[model samples]
Target: MATVTKPEGTIATTRKAEAEGDQLVTMRGIDWQGYLTILDMKTDRRFPRVVFLDGEVSFMSPSPTHEFLNDRLRSFLRAVLSGLGIPFLPLGSTTFRREERRGGVEGGQTYYLVNRGHVRDKKRIDLSVDPPPDLAVEIVVTHPADDTLEVYRRLRVPEVWVCTETELVFLVLDRNGHYARTDSSVALPGISAAEIHSWITRGGYDDEGAWDHDLRRWIAEVLSPRLRETTR
Candidate 1:
């Protein structure tokens, strides 16, 4: 049973399963942010061991904060995605459930990689999947690594937003595997990144009720009038 604190950014875990080797999936413990999974690039998705969170034990689940934040972001994104005619799954913590999603599964567990087989740089990450997410959101709280932005770039998540207690910064993954801020949201059209960032940093960060209501209201206001009709 081995565990490590959540890293702010992506940290290479020492453990890497051999090619075509059998991976022993075990659940030892759970971290607040979530856990990771290490998958064999070859075959047998079930065998790629899942570390952190219930550690070899599948009964237990993530903590309250993890569950709540996951739900909140997913719920919001699900709505926005639909409005923009984008297809996506919540895949918050469950993103680690799949073998290919277990890039950093062993040692550094809080953050999980999107796709495993197509890895470009060991130190610099460039994650890719057959069907990549249009966007991803991470509620950045407290963690070790000072550079959390690297994960989004490495994962090649297309567009990402990191919501801290203070602000929400949006980054768009480009052709060169770097991120840049944009006025319009690639995933959520009509959703202003600057306004959302400002709202997240305000005094209402702690109160979920107030924060959500305000966010929804803002979304409704900015979206096409036809959407408001359906939302109502």
Candidate 2:
């Protein structure tokens, strides 16, 4: 049950879906200014995540299960990166928008690993001047109305991980400026979607200390060695 007030003079066609406490509403023909107006109005609240693409806007209210999965994935990723000793800046649910491209999105868990140095000192990210996040993660408990991947593509985000109740997908932006599915992450080097999926599933029910211990051990004894050899 999420609501958005339509901006004046915009031809808005609405579509809504609700399941398991998740709600999505898509409005077509919303101008860029209208999108900004909506975002400005909702500055105080965090729910009803919004995305805009080519005059269309989608507002999504994530369910409890959706948020639970998001937290699990974030924790798993942080552990992996920490165990690997990679310096990364995590920007949770940051809204990225490029007015020129007419695209904008709020990432579930965005990270800056390769470009961490470039933006580390900055307080805000302006997509027109700043580099896009190296990696963006999306948790899909309920499907959004717009093509969010396309929005990321337009934003030129290098890598995107899409996680669901049963699947995890890795998409790397290729030279052709399109996202292509890959097994291993280009940003995280040796980490694979399958490995992350396995960890996320296990971490959901396992004790936190036990899960962290096992994951750290695996990274130290197995993944770390593999990465070192590859670099050599």
Candidate 3:
């Protein structure tokens, strides 16, 4: 979630054991761990990824796995994005973990606290109380989405998306809580954010469905066209 999430010029303070600075502010808010147990759902494999404010939860599953793969494909993406100028944050956790998980950790449904989310309306709501992850992308290995999607609605996020490794995608939460079959990225243009995501799927690779620079090329090329079209 912290792919340098904060803009460079925002804050220069640091959090450390024996370090002190003018911007140093101890977290005095919600019981993060206590609220970890909130993601409750009926799934044979229910893994609750606790949503937290620190970079800790993001460094783990869902976020971690996505980060790891993003890292794996970054080199290819960086060149393409740089050439095409596609800017974006890798994205972070969800709200359902806080309201549903109930401390049960499994299924890789990890959650990271977002900094801002859309509780209602187009306004960006920031709960200065709990750490908030702007958005959380959950991967469903296998399961239905009725209740799972509802969890996002309750949290009031501007957007929520779930990708099934490859096949189905649910972008159920819009800025105002409008669910839809097709979804676009807050950073990229297009009705379907498929170009970039292709790199995350099996199609993102060499002949054997393995990931390689080849898939990266396809992403760069495809994104280049999309960006040019949208930027124009």
Candidate 4:
């Protein structure tokens, strides 16, 4: 396979376009090692997420709306987990790479549940030695060249939630090591993708703080029985 690496500082040049909307750049021939080098270079700046699959690399700079939904959904997920009394560790946009699989990805919000406590204190995750997150959240106002679902599949991610302005796509990895679109999350039982969409895209909230307050109230009353009992 050909190896092509993007020169440093390319991401900095896209600020103008990023100001208008999301900017995406896809490059080919970058090996796994090259991906790691670029990742280290941008360790401190994580806005433009980098994805690596085989020799293809994609850098995605999310738009303001994308960021808004990303953060909103992230906060909502945490509220749901906490209300349900489930322990979780939020690893937002953490680059997870495995050279052996020649796959790497950074979700808008990624999280570990079953193994959250195990790696709670660690600062970095080595997928070669550590377990991958149970679920990854991807917000797609625009799509990219490389298939993120394919990347997640190759990385053996258990579940992925792909959200758009109009739709929420739920995917679960099957026993065959492939992702299949589903109606509900297998990782987050009783939570359908549509339900999450309804909550996230609810209208008439004057501000995010108000929305969050209403969301938490709804989650307590309608989503979690234990939370409802405690509140009552």
Off by over 4 Å in 3: 1-132, 145-148, 170-178, 191-198, 203-212
- lDDT of every predicted structure (CA atoms): 0.44, 0.83, 0.40, 0.78
lDDT of 3 by residue, 30-94 (tens): 23332232223213222233333322221122334444443433443344545555443333222
Q: After superposition, how far is residue 163 of candidate 4 from its true place, in Å?
A: 0.3
Best-to-worst order by lDDT is: 2, 4, 1, 3
Candidate 2 displacement at residue 7 in angstroms: 9.4
Local error of candidate 2 at 32, Å? Answer: 1.2
Q: Candidate 2's residue-wise lDDT over 1-232, tens digit each?
A: 2244455776679898867667898889787777888888885567788889988888888888788778778887888788888889998888899989989987778999988888887888998889999999988876752378899999999999998888899899999999999988887777777778888777454466777778788888999899999999
- On TM-score, the candidate that comes out on top is 2
Cα-based TM-score, every candidate: 0.47, 0.88, 0.45, 0.85
C-alpha RMSD by candidate, in order: 12.4, 3.4, 14.9, 5.2
Better lDDT candidate (3, 4):
4
**Per-residue alpha-carbon lDDT of model 1 for 46-151, expressed as tens digits?**
2222333322222112334434544565556655555555544443332322224332321111222333333323333323424344455655443312223453
Lowest-sum lDDT 10-residue window in model 4: 10-19
TM-score of 3: 0.45
